[model samples]
Target: MKATREAYGEALLDLGRLSDQVVALDADLSKSTKTSLFAKEFPERFFDVGIAEQNMIGIAAGLSLAGFVPFASTFAIFASGRAWEQIRNTVAYPSLNVKVCASHAGITVGEDGASHQSVEDIGLMSIIPNMTVLVPSDPIETKSIINWAFKYKGPVYVRLGRMGVPDLLPKDYSFDTKPYIFKKGKKIVIFATGIMLWKCLEAIELLKAYDIEPTLVNIPCLKPFPEKEIIEIVREHDMVFTAEEHSIIGGLGSMVASTLSRSYPMKVSFIGINDKFGTSGKPNDLLSFYGLDAAGIRDKLLDNIK
Candidate 1:
Protein backbone atom coordinates (compact mmCIF):
# COMPACT_ATOMS: atom_id res chain seq x y z
CA MET A 1 0.00 0.00 0.00
CA LYS A 2 1.20 3.46 -0.86
CA ALA A 3 1.70 5.82 2.06
CA THR A 4 0.33 9.34 1.98
CA ARG A 5 2.22 12.61 2.41
CA GLU A 6 -0.52 13.40 4.89
CA ALA A 7 1.49 11.51 7.48
CA TYR A 8 3.83 14.53 7.50
CA GLY A 9 0.73 16.57 8.27
CA GLU A 10 0.08 14.49 11.38
CA ALA A 11 3.67 14.79 12.51
CA LEU A 12 4.05 18.56 12.00
CA LEU A 13 0.78 19.18 13.82
CA ASP A 14 2.15 17.36 16.86
CA LEU A 15 5.40 19.31 16.63
CA GLY A 16 3.65 22.68 16.59
CA ARG A 17 2.05 22.09 20.00
CA LEU A 18 5.42 21.28 21.55
CA SER A 19 7.22 24.42 20.39
CA ASP A 20 5.80 27.83 21.28
CA GLN A 21 7.83 29.58 18.63
CA VAL A 22 6.86 27.20 15.82
CA VAL A 23 5.28 29.16 12.97
CA ALA A 24 4.13 27.89 9.55
CA LEU A 25 3.98 29.82 6.26
CA ASP A 26 2.85 28.75 2.79
CA ALA A 27 3.06 30.17 -0.72
CA ASP A 28 -0.48 29.28 -1.74
CA LEU A 29 0.28 25.59 -1.13
CA SER A 30 -0.80 24.67 2.36
CA LYS A 31 -2.81 21.64 1.22
CA SER A 32 -0.13 20.50 -1.19
CA THR A 33 2.69 20.71 1.36
CA LYS A 34 0.54 18.85 3.92
CA THR A 35 0.91 21.89 6.21
CA SER A 36 -2.82 22.65 6.30
CA LEU A 37 -3.09 20.83 9.62
CA PHE A 38 -0.36 23.04 11.02
CA ALA A 39 -2.42 26.01 9.88
CA LYS A 40 -5.70 24.61 11.25
CA GLU A 41 -4.20 23.96 14.66
CA PHE A 42 -2.10 27.09 15.04
CA PRO A 43 -4.12 29.74 13.28
CA GLU A 44 -2.28 32.61 14.90
CA ARG A 45 1.14 31.16 14.06
CA PHE A 46 0.38 30.14 10.48
CA PHE A 47 0.42 32.56 7.54
CA ASP A 48 -0.35 32.09 3.84
CA VAL A 49 1.83 34.69 2.09
CA GLY A 50 -0.02 34.60 -1.23
CA ILE A 51 1.65 33.34 -4.42
CA ALA A 52 4.71 35.55 -4.16
CA GLU A 53 7.45 33.18 -3.03
CA GLN A 54 10.09 35.92 -2.76
CA ASN A 55 7.89 38.04 -0.52
CA MET A 56 6.86 34.97 1.46
CA ILE A 57 10.52 34.37 2.25
CA GLY A 58 10.93 37.97 3.34
CA ILE A 59 8.06 37.52 5.75
CA ALA A 60 9.66 34.35 7.11
CA ALA A 61 12.95 36.16 7.63
CA GLY A 62 11.17 39.06 9.34
CA LEU A 63 9.35 36.63 11.62
CA SER A 64 12.63 34.93 12.47
CA LEU A 65 14.19 38.27 13.30
CA ALA A 66 11.37 38.74 15.80
CA GLY A 67 12.45 35.50 17.55
CA PHE A 68 9.98 33.19 15.87
CA VAL A 69 11.11 29.82 14.51
CA PRO A 70 9.36 29.96 11.14
CA PHE A 71 8.79 26.94 8.91
CA ALA A 72 8.13 28.04 5.33
CA SER A 73 6.40 25.72 2.87
CA THR A 74 5.96 25.65 -0.92
CA PHE A 75 6.51 23.49 -3.97
CA ALA A 76 10.24 22.86 -4.51
CA ILE A 77 10.37 24.88 -7.76
CA PHE A 78 9.19 28.19 -6.29
CA ALA A 79 10.99 27.86 -2.97
CA SER A 80 14.35 27.35 -4.66
CA GLY A 81 14.10 29.21 -7.98
CA ARG A 82 11.49 31.87 -7.22
CA ALA A 83 12.64 32.84 -3.75
CA TRP A 84 16.35 32.09 -4.15
CA GLU A 85 17.42 35.74 -3.92
CA GLN A 86 15.27 36.38 -0.87
CA ILE A 87 16.44 33.11 0.69
CA ARG A 88 20.07 34.02 0.07
CA ASN A 89 19.78 37.57 1.38
CA THR A 90 17.19 37.23 4.14
CA VAL A 91 17.66 33.72 5.51
CA ALA A 92 21.07 32.33 4.59
CA TYR A 93 23.10 35.53 4.45
CA PRO A 94 21.99 36.48 7.95
CA SER A 95 22.16 32.87 9.13
CA LEU A 96 18.63 33.38 10.38
CA ASN A 97 16.78 30.61 12.23
CA VAL A 98 14.39 29.83 9.39
CA LYS A 99 13.19 26.43 8.19
CA VAL A 100 12.19 25.88 4.54
CA CYS A 101 10.03 22.82 3.88
CA ALA A 102 9.81 22.09 0.12
CA SER A 103 7.35 19.43 -1.00
CA HIS A 104 6.67 17.83 -4.43
CA ALA A 105 10.40 17.59 -4.85
CA GLY A 106 12.16 15.58 -7.56
CA ILE A 107 10.60 13.71 -10.52
CA THR A 108 8.18 12.00 -8.20
CA VAL A 109 5.85 14.95 -8.61
CA GLY A 110 4.65 12.78 -11.53
CA GLU A 111 2.06 13.51 -14.29
CA ASP A 112 2.69 17.18 -13.59
CA GLY A 113 5.89 16.66 -15.62
CA ALA A 114 9.35 18.28 -15.33
CA SER A 115 8.09 21.83 -14.99
CA HIS A 116 6.54 20.96 -11.61
CA GLN A 117 9.47 18.77 -10.58
CA SER A 118 12.39 20.35 -8.77
CA VAL A 119 15.14 17.92 -9.76
CA GLU A 120 18.00 20.14 -8.57
CA ASP A 121 16.47 21.48 -5.38
CA ILE A 122 18.72 19.38 -3.18
CA GLY A 123 21.83 20.62 -4.94
CA LEU A 124 20.55 24.19 -4.92
CA MET A 125 19.88 24.23 -1.17
CA SER A 126 22.95 22.21 -0.14
CA ILE A 127 25.32 24.66 -1.84
CA ILE A 128 24.00 27.67 0.06
CA PRO A 129 26.52 28.91 2.61
CA ASN A 130 25.53 28.20 6.20
CA MET A 131 22.34 26.50 5.01
CA THR A 132 21.66 23.08 6.50
CA VAL A 133 20.07 20.60 4.04
CA LEU A 134 17.94 17.78 5.42
CA VAL A 135 16.46 15.12 3.07
CA PRO A 136 14.38 12.60 5.01
CA SER A 137 13.92 9.15 3.47
CA ASP A 138 10.31 8.68 4.59
CA PRO A 139 7.44 10.39 6.34
CA ILE A 140 8.46 9.17 9.81
CA GLU A 141 11.96 10.53 9.38
CA THR A 142 10.48 13.71 7.92
CA LYS A 143 8.61 14.42 11.16
CA SER A 144 11.51 13.74 13.50
CA ILE A 145 13.94 15.88 11.50
CA ILE A 146 11.41 18.71 11.22
CA ASN A 147 11.02 18.54 15.00
CA TRP A 148 14.79 18.52 15.40
CA ALA A 149 15.13 21.61 13.18
CA PHE A 150 13.20 23.55 15.81
CA LYS A 151 16.07 22.99 18.23
CA TYR A 152 18.71 23.71 15.58
CA LYS A 153 19.58 27.43 15.37
CA GLY A 154 20.33 28.10 11.71
CA PRO A 155 18.82 28.30 8.24
CA VAL A 156 17.56 24.87 7.10
CA TYR A 157 16.14 23.69 3.75
CA VAL A 158 14.36 20.36 4.13
CA ARG A 159 13.09 18.41 1.11
CA LEU A 160 9.81 16.50 1.35
CA GLY A 161 7.74 14.78 -1.37
CA ARG A 162 4.23 14.89 -2.82
CA MET A 163 4.26 11.10 -3.38
CA GLY A 164 3.82 8.54 -0.62
CA VAL A 165 6.73 6.19 0.09
CA PRO A 166 7.43 3.11 2.10
CA ASP A 167 8.71 3.62 5.65
CA LEU A 168 12.19 2.23 5.02
CA LEU A 169 13.62 3.26 8.37
CA PRO A 170 12.26 1.89 11.62
CA LYS A 171 9.41 3.80 13.24
CA ASP A 172 11.60 4.49 16.27
CA TYR A 173 14.50 5.58 14.08
CA SER A 174 15.60 9.10 15.05
CA PHE A 175 18.19 11.59 13.88
CA ASP A 176 20.82 12.13 16.62
CA THR A 177 21.15 15.83 15.63
CA LYS A 178 23.87 13.97 13.82
CA PRO A 179 24.03 11.43 10.97
CA TYR A 180 22.49 8.04 11.66
CA ILE A 181 24.23 4.84 10.49
CA PHE A 182 22.05 1.87 9.52
CA LYS A 183 23.73 -0.96 7.56
CA LYS A 184 27.42 -1.87 8.02
CA GLY A 185 29.57 -3.77 5.55
CA LYS A 186 32.99 -3.72 3.92
CA LYS A 187 32.89 -4.57 0.17
CA ILE A 188 30.65 -1.71 -0.96
CA VAL A 189 28.55 0.93 0.77
CA ILE A 190 25.20 1.96 -0.70
CA PHE A 191 24.51 5.48 0.57
CA ALA A 192 21.04 6.65 -0.35
CA THR A 193 18.82 9.67 0.31
CA GLY A 194 15.10 10.58 0.08
CA ILE A 195 12.62 8.15 -1.55
CA MET A 196 15.49 6.36 -3.24
CA LEU A 197 16.50 5.01 0.17
CA TRP A 198 13.71 2.46 -0.14
CA LYS A 199 14.93 1.55 -3.61
CA CYS A 200 18.41 1.00 -2.20
CA LEU A 201 16.94 -1.10 0.55
CA GLU A 202 15.44 -3.37 -2.10
CA ALA A 203 18.78 -3.42 -3.88
CA ILE A 204 20.39 -4.56 -0.65
CA GLU A 205 17.91 -7.43 -0.44
CA LEU A 206 18.86 -8.47 -3.99
CA LEU A 207 22.59 -8.10 -3.31
CA LYS A 208 22.27 -10.29 -0.23
CA ALA A 209 21.01 -13.12 -2.44
CA TYR A 210 24.54 -13.21 -3.79
CA ASP A 211 25.90 -12.71 -0.24
CA ILE A 212 26.90 -9.16 -1.03
CA GLU A 213 26.07 -7.07 2.02
CA PRO A 214 26.86 -3.49 1.17
CA THR A 215 26.81 -0.83 3.88
CA LEU A 216 23.76 1.47 3.69
CA VAL A 217 24.06 4.92 5.22
CA ASN A 218 21.13 7.33 5.45
CA ILE A 219 22.21 10.96 5.44
CA PRO A 220 19.06 12.80 6.54
CA CYS A 221 21.18 15.83 7.14
CA LEU A 222 22.87 16.26 3.76
CA LYS A 223 24.64 19.52 4.54
CA PRO A 224 27.51 19.58 7.01
CA PHE A 225 27.25 16.12 5.34
CA PRO A 226 28.53 13.43 7.61
CA GLU A 227 31.89 14.06 5.96
CA LYS A 228 33.85 12.42 8.77
CA GLU A 229 31.61 9.34 8.76
CA ILE A 230 31.41 9.14 4.95
CA ILE A 231 35.18 9.30 4.65
CA GLU A 232 35.62 6.65 7.31
CA ILE A 233 33.10 4.30 5.66
CA VAL A 234 34.53 4.80 2.15
CA ARG A 235 38.04 4.06 3.39
CA GLU A 236 36.87 0.63 4.57
CA HIS A 237 34.85 -0.20 1.44
CA ASP A 238 36.18 -1.18 -1.99
CA MET A 239 33.57 0.87 -3.88
CA VAL A 240 30.39 2.90 -3.31
CA PHE A 241 26.92 3.22 -4.85
CA THR A 242 24.95 6.43 -4.36
CA ALA A 243 21.30 6.85 -5.28
CA GLU A 244 18.41 9.33 -5.18
CA GLU A 245 15.11 10.10 -7.00
CA HIS A 246 16.48 13.33 -8.46
CA SER A 247 18.71 13.93 -11.45
CA ILE A 248 22.08 12.17 -11.58
CA ILE A 249 23.89 15.46 -12.22
CA GLY A 250 23.52 17.22 -8.85
CA GLY A 251 21.61 15.00 -6.45
CA LEU A 252 22.84 12.59 -3.78
CA GLY A 253 24.88 10.35 -6.07
CA SER A 254 26.82 13.25 -7.61
CA MET A 255 27.47 14.78 -4.21
CA VAL A 256 28.88 11.50 -2.90
CA ALA A 257 30.93 10.77 -6.04
CA SER A 258 32.43 14.29 -6.11
CA THR A 259 33.36 14.08 -2.44
CA LEU A 260 34.91 10.60 -2.79
CA SER A 261 36.78 11.29 -6.07
CA ARG A 262 38.70 14.19 -4.52
CA SER A 263 39.27 12.78 -1.02
CA TYR A 264 38.95 8.99 -1.08
CA PRO A 265 39.30 8.13 -4.81
CA MET A 266 36.77 5.25 -4.91
CA LYS A 267 34.28 4.39 -7.65
CA VAL A 268 30.59 5.22 -7.07
CA SER A 269 27.72 3.74 -9.13
CA PHE A 270 24.98 6.35 -9.47
CA ILE A 271 21.37 5.14 -9.86
CA GLY A 272 18.86 7.86 -10.62
CA ILE A 273 17.18 9.83 -13.38
CA ASN A 274 19.58 10.48 -16.25
CA ASP A 275 19.81 13.96 -17.85
CA LYS A 276 16.30 13.79 -19.37
CA PHE A 277 13.44 15.81 -17.81
CA GLY A 278 10.64 13.61 -16.42
CA THR A 279 7.31 13.02 -18.21
CA SER A 280 3.69 12.83 -17.07
CA GLY A 281 2.71 9.40 -15.67
CA LYS A 282 1.55 7.58 -12.58
CA PRO A 283 4.03 7.79 -9.73
CA ASN A 284 4.95 4.11 -10.08
CA ASP A 285 5.06 4.45 -13.85
CA LEU A 286 7.37 7.44 -13.46
CA LEU A 287 9.54 5.48 -11.07
CA SER A 288 9.99 2.69 -13.60
CA PHE A 289 10.21 5.13 -16.52
CA TYR A 290 12.95 7.17 -14.85
CA GLY A 291 14.77 4.08 -13.46
CA LEU A 292 14.08 5.27 -9.94
CA ASP A 293 12.48 2.02 -8.82
CA ALA A 294 14.03 -0.67 -6.61
CA ALA A 295 14.41 -3.31 -9.34
CA GLY A 296 15.92 -0.71 -11.66
CA ILE A 297 18.36 0.38 -8.97
CA ARG A 298 19.23 -3.27 -8.34
CA ASP A 299 19.95 -3.80 -12.03
CA LYS A 300 22.23 -0.77 -12.19
CA LEU A 301 24.17 -1.69 -9.06
CA LEU A 302 24.55 -5.33 -10.16
CA ASP A 303 25.71 -4.48 -13.69
CA ASN A 304 28.47 -2.11 -12.55
CA ILE A 305 29.89 -3.89 -9.48
CA LYS A 306 30.48 -7.61 -8.62
Candidate 2:
Protein backbone atom coordinates (compact mmCIF):
# COMPACT_ATOMS: atom_id res chain seq x y z
CA MET A 1 0.00 0.00 0.00
CA LYS A 2 1.15 3.51 -0.84
CA ALA A 3 -0.14 7.06 -0.64
CA THR A 4 -0.63 9.11 -3.78
CA ARG A 5 1.47 11.90 -2.23
CA GLU A 6 4.44 9.49 -2.12
CA ALA A 7 4.00 8.80 -5.82
CA TYR A 8 3.81 12.56 -6.43
CA GLY A 9 7.15 13.11 -4.69
CA GLU A 10 8.76 10.30 -6.72
CA ALA A 11 7.19 11.65 -9.89
CA LEU A 12 8.59 15.12 -9.21
CA LEU A 13 12.06 13.63 -8.78
CA ASP A 14 11.67 11.73 -12.05
CA LEU A 15 10.42 14.86 -13.78
CA GLY A 16 13.37 16.83 -12.45
CA ARG A 17 15.73 14.30 -14.01
CA LEU A 18 13.90 14.48 -17.35
CA SER A 19 13.79 18.28 -17.57
CA ASP A 20 15.80 20.99 -15.91
CA GLN A 21 12.91 23.43 -16.37
CA VAL A 22 10.86 21.45 -13.84
CA VAL A 23 10.90 23.20 -10.45
CA ALA A 24 8.99 22.70 -7.17
CA LEU A 25 7.59 25.16 -4.61
CA ASP A 26 6.08 24.31 -1.24
CA ALA A 27 4.27 26.32 1.47
CA ASP A 28 6.36 25.11 4.40
CA LEU A 29 4.66 21.74 4.16
CA SER A 30 7.35 19.99 2.13
CA LYS A 31 7.69 17.14 4.58
CA SER A 32 3.93 16.60 4.80
CA THR A 33 3.32 17.01 1.07
CA LYS A 34 6.38 14.82 0.36
CA THR A 35 7.96 17.55 -1.80
CA SER A 36 10.92 17.38 0.58
CA LEU A 37 12.09 14.37 -1.42
CA PHE A 38 12.48 16.55 -4.50
CA ALA A 39 14.02 19.35 -2.39
CA LYS A 40 16.71 16.93 -1.20
CA GLU A 41 17.92 16.19 -4.70
CA PHE A 42 17.41 19.60 -6.29
CA PRO A 43 17.99 22.14 -3.55
CA GLU A 44 18.56 25.00 -5.95
CA ARG A 45 15.40 24.23 -7.95
CA PHE A 46 13.20 23.72 -4.87
CA PHE A 47 11.81 26.72 -2.97
CA ASP A 48 10.21 26.52 0.45
CA VAL A 49 7.84 29.53 0.57
CA GLY A 50 7.24 29.07 4.32
CA ILE A 51 3.46 28.92 5.00
CA ALA A 52 2.78 31.77 2.60
CA GLU A 53 0.61 29.90 0.09
CA GLN A 54 -0.45 33.05 -1.72
CA ASN A 55 3.16 34.15 -2.21
CA MET A 56 4.11 30.63 -3.22
CA ILE A 57 1.50 30.71 -5.99
CA GLY A 58 2.73 34.09 -7.21
CA ILE A 59 6.28 32.77 -7.36
CA ALA A 60 5.11 29.73 -9.29
CA ALA A 61 3.26 31.95 -11.75
CA GLY A 62 6.41 34.01 -12.24
CA LEU A 63 8.41 30.82 -12.82
CA SER A 64 5.88 29.67 -15.43
CA LEU A 65 6.16 33.00 -17.25
CA ALA A 66 9.95 32.54 -17.27
CA GLY A 67 9.59 29.24 -19.18
CA PHE A 68 9.76 26.98 -16.14
CA VAL A 69 7.25 24.24 -15.41
CA PRO A 70 6.55 25.01 -11.76
CA PHE A 71 4.84 22.48 -9.51
CA ALA A 72 3.51 23.98 -6.27
CA SER A 73 2.85 21.61 -3.39
CA THR A 74 0.74 22.34 -0.28
CA PHE A 75 -2.20 21.12 1.74
CA ALA A 76 -5.50 21.14 -0.16
CA ILE A 77 -7.20 23.68 2.08
CA PHE A 78 -4.40 26.23 1.74
CA ALA A 79 -3.84 25.59 -1.96
CA SER A 80 -7.47 25.91 -2.97
CA GLY A 81 -8.73 28.19 -0.23
CA ARG A 82 -5.87 30.49 0.81
CA ALA A 83 -4.27 30.90 -2.61
CA TRP A 84 -7.32 30.66 -4.81
CA GLU A 85 -7.24 34.28 -5.93
CA GLN A 86 -3.57 34.12 -6.82
CA ILE A 87 -4.12 30.92 -8.73
CA ARG A 88 -7.12 32.34 -10.53
CA ASN A 89 -5.52 35.64 -11.50
CA THR A 90 -1.85 34.76 -11.86
CA VAL A 91 -1.57 31.20 -13.16
CA ALA A 92 -5.03 30.10 -14.34
CA TYR A 93 -5.95 33.40 -15.94
CA PRO A 94 -2.85 33.30 -18.12
CA SER A 95 -3.19 29.55 -18.59
CA LEU A 96 0.39 29.04 -17.46
CA ASN A 97 2.12 25.68 -17.14
CA VAL A 98 1.80 25.65 -13.36
CA LYS A 99 0.73 22.46 -11.62
CA VAL A 100 -0.73 22.74 -8.11
CA CYS A 101 -0.61 19.25 -6.67
CA ALA A 102 -2.27 19.37 -3.26
CA SER A 103 -1.98 16.59 -0.68
CA HIS A 104 -4.18 15.60 2.30
CA ALA A 105 -7.44 16.45 0.56
CA GLY A 106 -10.94 15.57 1.74
CA ILE A 107 -12.02 13.64 4.87
CA THR A 108 -9.04 11.35 4.56
CA VAL A 109 -6.92 14.05 6.18
CA GLY A 110 -8.07 12.46 9.39
CA GLU A 111 -7.40 13.88 12.89
CA ASP A 112 -6.78 17.26 11.29
CA GLY A 113 -10.37 18.51 11.79
CA ALA A 114 -12.42 20.59 9.33
CA SER A 115 -9.98 23.45 8.95
CA HIS A 116 -7.25 21.24 7.47
CA GLN A 117 -9.52 18.84 5.58
CA SER A 118 -10.60 20.06 2.15
CA VAL A 119 -13.91 18.72 0.95
CA GLU A 120 -14.51 21.47 -1.61
CA ASP A 121 -11.12 21.84 -3.22
CA ILE A 122 -12.18 20.14 -6.45
CA GLY A 123 -15.23 22.33 -6.85
CA LEU A 124 -13.26 25.47 -6.08
CA MET A 125 -10.50 24.65 -8.56
CA SER A 126 -12.91 23.40 -11.24
CA ILE A 127 -14.74 26.72 -11.21
CA ILE A 128 -11.66 28.49 -12.47
CA PRO A 129 -11.46 28.67 -16.25
CA ASN A 130 -8.52 26.76 -17.83
CA MET A 131 -7.92 24.95 -14.53
CA THR A 132 -7.83 21.16 -14.89
CA VAL A 133 -8.83 19.11 -11.84
CA LEU A 134 -7.71 15.51 -11.36
CA VAL A 135 -7.96 12.92 -8.56
CA PRO A 136 -5.92 9.74 -8.97
CA SER A 137 -7.22 6.50 -7.44
CA ASP A 138 -3.87 5.02 -6.40
CA PRO A 139 -0.10 5.58 -6.43
CA ILE A 140 0.45 4.27 -9.99
CA GLU A 141 -2.32 6.41 -11.40
CA THR A 142 -1.00 9.42 -9.47
CA LYS A 143 2.40 9.05 -11.14
CA SER A 144 0.76 8.72 -14.52
CA ILE A 145 -1.36 11.83 -13.96
CA ILE A 146 1.69 13.79 -12.81
CA ASN A 147 3.41 12.85 -16.04
CA TRP A 148 0.38 13.94 -18.03
CA ALA A 149 0.17 17.24 -16.14
CA PHE A 150 3.79 17.97 -17.02
CA LYS A 151 3.14 17.26 -20.68
CA TYR A 152 -0.03 19.33 -20.80
CA LYS A 153 0.66 23.06 -20.84
CA GLY A 154 -1.80 24.75 -18.53
CA PRO A 155 -2.80 25.15 -14.89
CA VAL A 156 -3.74 21.89 -13.18
CA TYR A 157 -4.94 20.91 -9.69
CA VAL A 158 -4.29 17.31 -8.62
CA ARG A 159 -5.93 16.21 -5.35
CA LEU A 160 -4.09 13.58 -3.32
CA GLY A 161 -5.00 11.98 0.01
CA ARG A 162 -2.88 11.44 3.16
CA MET A 163 -3.82 7.81 3.85
CA GLY A 164 -2.13 4.84 2.20
CA VAL A 165 -4.58 2.98 -0.03
CA PRO A 166 -4.60 -0.37 -1.80
CA ASP A 167 -3.75 -0.32 -5.47
CA LEU A 168 -6.82 -0.95 -7.63
CA LEU A 169 -5.34 -0.44 -11.07
CA PRO A 170 -2.79 -2.65 -12.76
CA LYS A 171 0.93 -1.93 -12.22
CA ASP A 172 1.25 -1.00 -15.88
CA TYR A 173 -1.79 1.25 -15.91
CA SER A 174 -1.37 4.57 -17.69
CA PHE A 175 -3.25 7.81 -17.06
CA ASP A 176 -6.24 8.71 -19.22
CA THR A 177 -8.92 11.37 -18.74
CA LYS A 178 -11.63 8.83 -19.48
CA PRO A 179 -13.26 6.77 -16.77
CA TYR A 180 -11.88 3.29 -16.07
CA ILE A 181 -14.40 0.45 -16.00
CA PHE A 182 -13.43 -1.88 -13.16
CA LYS A 183 -16.41 -4.19 -13.61
CA LYS A 184 -19.41 -4.52 -15.94
CA GLY A 185 -22.92 -5.09 -14.66
CA LYS A 186 -26.38 -4.23 -15.95
CA LYS A 187 -28.72 -3.18 -13.16
CA ILE A 188 -26.80 -0.22 -11.72
CA VAL A 189 -23.60 1.74 -12.19
CA ILE A 190 -21.38 3.10 -9.41
CA PHE A 191 -19.04 5.98 -10.21
CA ALA A 192 -16.29 6.55 -7.64
CA THR A 193 -13.27 8.79 -7.28
CA GLY A 194 -10.17 8.99 -5.04
CA ILE A 195 -10.00 6.48 -2.17
CA MET A 196 -13.71 5.77 -2.53
CA LEU A 197 -12.89 3.64 -5.57
CA TRP A 198 -11.35 1.00 -3.31
CA LYS A 199 -14.40 0.98 -1.06
CA CYS A 200 -16.68 0.73 -4.07
CA LEU A 201 -14.76 -2.31 -5.28
CA GLU A 202 -15.20 -3.99 -1.91
CA ALA A 203 -18.88 -3.11 -1.95
CA ILE A 204 -19.20 -4.87 -5.31
CA GLU A 205 -17.88 -8.07 -3.79
CA LEU A 206 -20.35 -7.91 -0.90
CA LEU A 207 -23.11 -7.15 -3.41
CA LYS A 208 -22.45 -10.48 -5.12
CA ALA A 209 -23.84 -12.42 -2.17
CA TYR A 210 -27.04 -10.40 -2.32
CA ASP A 211 -27.38 -11.14 -6.06
CA ILE A 212 -27.04 -7.42 -6.81
CA GLU A 213 -24.65 -6.61 -9.59
CA PRO A 214 -23.47 -3.10 -10.42
CA THR A 215 -20.96 -1.71 -12.85
CA LEU A 216 -18.00 0.08 -11.21
CA VAL A 217 -16.42 3.10 -12.89
CA ASN A 218 -13.39 4.91 -11.47
CA ILE A 219 -13.47 8.61 -12.38
CA PRO A 220 -9.90 9.78 -12.08
CA CYS A 221 -10.50 13.02 -13.92
CA LEU A 222 -12.94 15.35 -12.17
CA LYS A 223 -12.85 18.47 -14.36
CA PRO A 224 -13.28 18.03 -18.10
CA PHE A 225 -15.40 15.16 -16.90
CA PRO A 226 -15.89 12.34 -19.40
CA GLU A 227 -19.44 13.33 -20.23
CA LYS A 228 -19.77 11.36 -23.46
CA GLU A 229 -18.60 8.13 -21.87
CA ILE A 230 -20.76 8.72 -18.79
CA ILE A 231 -23.83 9.29 -20.93
CA GLU A 232 -23.13 6.11 -22.87
CA ILE A 233 -22.58 4.06 -19.73
CA VAL A 234 -25.69 5.39 -17.99
CA ARG A 235 -27.73 4.43 -21.03
CA GLU A 236 -27.03 0.78 -20.19
CA HIS A 237 -27.97 0.94 -16.51
CA ASP A 238 -31.16 1.62 -14.54
CA MET A 239 -29.58 3.98 -12.03
CA VAL A 240 -26.27 5.72 -11.26
CA PHE A 241 -24.53 6.34 -7.94
CA THR A 242 -21.59 8.69 -7.49
CA ALA A 243 -19.21 8.20 -4.57
CA GLU A 244 -16.49 10.60 -3.44
CA GLU A 245 -14.72 11.81 -0.29
CA HIS A 246 -16.22 15.28 -0.75
CA SER A 247 -19.39 17.22 -0.25
CA ILE A 248 -22.33 16.05 -2.39
CA ILE A 249 -23.09 19.66 -3.35
CA GLY A 250 -20.33 20.46 -5.87
CA GLY A 251 -17.82 17.67 -6.11
CA LEU A 252 -17.78 14.50 -8.24
CA GLY A 253 -21.40 13.76 -7.42
CA SER A 254 -22.58 17.13 -8.67
CA MET A 255 -20.51 16.86 -11.83
CA VAL A 256 -21.87 13.40 -12.68
CA ALA A 257 -25.39 14.38 -11.70
CA SER A 258 -25.26 17.48 -13.87
CA THR A 259 -24.04 15.50 -16.87
CA LEU A 260 -26.70 12.82 -16.53
CA SER A 261 -29.49 15.28 -15.74
CA ARG A 262 -28.82 17.19 -18.94
CA SER A 263 -28.40 14.24 -21.32
CA TYR A 264 -29.51 10.95 -19.71
CA PRO A 265 -31.99 11.97 -16.94
CA MET A 266 -31.81 8.89 -14.72
CA LYS A 267 -32.16 8.30 -10.97
CA VAL A 268 -28.78 9.34 -9.54
CA SER A 269 -27.83 8.84 -5.91
CA PHE A 270 -24.83 10.44 -4.23
CA ILE A 271 -22.57 8.90 -1.59
CA GLY A 272 -20.37 11.52 0.04
CA ILE A 273 -20.03 14.03 2.85
CA ASN A 274 -23.48 15.61 2.92
CA ASP A 275 -22.91 19.30 3.68
CA LYS A 276 -21.02 18.74 6.93
CA PHE A 277 -17.60 19.56 8.31
CA GLY A 278 -15.18 16.72 9.01
CA THR A 279 -14.00 16.05 12.59
CA SER A 280 -10.76 14.73 14.03
CA GLY A 281 -10.54 10.94 14.13
CA LYS A 282 -8.79 7.93 12.65
CA PRO A 283 -9.15 7.84 8.87
CA ASN A 284 -10.72 4.41 8.77
CA ASP A 285 -13.06 5.24 11.65
CA LEU A 286 -14.13 8.48 9.97
CA LEU A 287 -14.88 6.66 6.72
CA SER A 288 -17.02 4.12 8.57
CA PHE A 289 -18.77 6.81 10.62
CA TYR A 290 -19.73 8.72 7.49
CA GLY A 291 -21.00 5.61 5.68
CA LEU A 292 -18.16 5.66 3.19
CA ASP A 293 -16.68 2.25 4.04
CA ALA A 294 -17.30 -0.95 2.04
CA ALA A 295 -20.03 -2.29 4.30
CA GLY A 296 -21.61 1.15 4.61
CA ILE A 297 -21.69 1.58 0.84
CA ARG A 298 -23.22 -1.86 0.40
CA ASP A 299 -25.96 -1.09 2.91
CA LYS A 300 -26.72 2.26 1.26
CA LEU A 301 -26.98 0.61 -2.14
CA LEU A 302 -29.30 -2.10 -0.82
CA ASP A 303 -31.51 0.53 0.79
CA ASN A 304 -31.70 2.62 -2.34
CA ILE A 305 -32.42 -0.32 -4.61
CA LYS A 306 -35.07 -1.84 -2.37
Q: What is the lDDT of residue 95 in candidate 1?
A: 100
Q: Could you estimate the TM-score for every candidate?
A: 0.94, 0.99
Model 2 Cα RMSD, Å?
A: 0.8
- Among the numbered candidates, top lDDT falls to 2
Most accurate candidate by TM-score:
2
Model 1 lDDT per residue over 20-106, tens place: 788889988898988899999899999998898898899999999999999898998889888888888889998999999888888
The sequence of per-residue lDDT tens digits that candidate 2 reaches over residues 141-255 is 9999999999998999999999998878998998889999988887899999999999999999999999999999999998888999999888888988999999998899999
Q: Please report how far candidate 2 places residue 262 from its true position, in Å.
A: 1.1
Clash numbers, per candidate: 0, 0
* Candidate 1 pairs with clashing backbones: none
Q: What residue pairs clash in candidate 2, if any at all?
A: none
